[model samples]
Target: MNDRTDAGGNPGPEQPGPEPTGPEHTGQPGQGAADGLARRAAAGFHRTEDGQVDVLRTVGGVRGLAESIVPGVVFLSAFTATQALNPSLVAALAVAAAFTVARLAQRTPLTQALAGLAGVVVCALVARSTGEAKDYYVPGFYTNAAYGTAMLLSIAVRWPFMGLVFGFIRGEGTHWRGDRRRQRAYAAATWAIVAVFAARLAVQLPLYFADQVQALGAARLVMGLPLYAMGLWLAWLISRPVAAAEGPRV
Candidate 1:
């Protein structure tokens, strides 16, 4: 009985010792390493997915909406300031510089610079042509009013184009917002800029028609105050952190 009990307690052919629980229990160290690597990879992928979602959510908010309005306001202000100071080649160069800066801030420096150069050329040609044409040319004040109107109208037409150009230049993935939302925001912002610009012209139109403000220079300075302030305010509003949060991914 003692011999049988001892044999039972001893290792038997049918029963092997309990398997090892240590790292060595695995087939090889490399296998353990591979498993660890896979877990890390999976974790990384999940983190990336979560981060992308957060970015999308932020862009969908009001901040993104405000950010979208900023570049336009900046451009308008730059144009006004440049025109006020130089009124000719210098002003055009200033506008070009402003557009380039705006694009650069959005991360599309080269493309914006090229586009701005093209715009400057076109504007210069138009200005020169009108200046030379007796029929097309009017008093500076009327000319200024007409020019302001034309600019505002152009803003209306080019709002989308500007958005597209800026997006491409900046490598912003694409229009994240739906067409309806984008259009609505753009229209509202563009109209606001135009309205302000037009108001300044309206204030001067009477004086212009009455020959009270002779030089476009005097009218420009007089009307510029309100317009400049309004433009700066608009820019400040657009540059708020909330605005940046609302931009669409692409």
Candidate 2:
């Protein structure tokens, strides 16, 4: 009647907007599916003697840790000694390749080896393309940015990535979201990891801007395992209740 609505009280054409394309508008992977995935991941994974998450065991352990650090160390050491990009990149690649071969020869799982090699390859390519030593760390910076964003999104959606990953890794699938308490626990753990990723970017992004290759490398080395270990411990502690608590949120 006021030039916008009809006599029946329906609104008129002056307010017609586009249709919604949000989660409610689409049949995307909703919280229900995410819940299932997380449940599956955590099913078989039980706490250890030290009360650690079971999925934490299969994550490359000491060997995976070694594969992750050696290449960066080699790269930094080579560059420090020679003050050149090519040799340093070459050394990093060599170490990655050698690690791959060792894994293959030892008949150990090559997932970690291959992933380390791939990361080195990408970093070397970036450094070479830019002809700057600091650019070598660009890939890792972008990786942190991407992962941090994804973690934030996952938490925002109430389907925390930690729940999904642990569900799969623990091979128990997920029902954590069913309980408000467990849901909060996993969300906190997920955010802890997100903090680690974000902190890396926050610290290293400055060094990258300054082109302080040594400082960047040092930060990477220091923050890499130590920071992640802290996050892991935090996650373990948060999830301890999941193992001890009788059931989901109820």
How many clashes in candidate 2? 16
Model 2, residue 90: what's the lDDT? 93
Report lDDT per candidate. 0.34, 0.65
| Candidate 2 accuracy as lDDT | 0.65
Error of 1 at 98 (Å): 22
User: What's the distance in Å from true for residue 6, model 1?
Assistant: 99
lDDT of 1 by residue, 131-183 (tens): 52111112323434454465356455643322232222222212312355544
Best by TM-score: 2
Off by over 4 Å in 2: 1-36, 39-47, 54-59, 167-172, 242-250
In model 2, how large is the Cα lDDT of residue 199?
81
Candidate 2, residue 183: the lDDT equals 74
TM-score of each: 0.32, 0.76
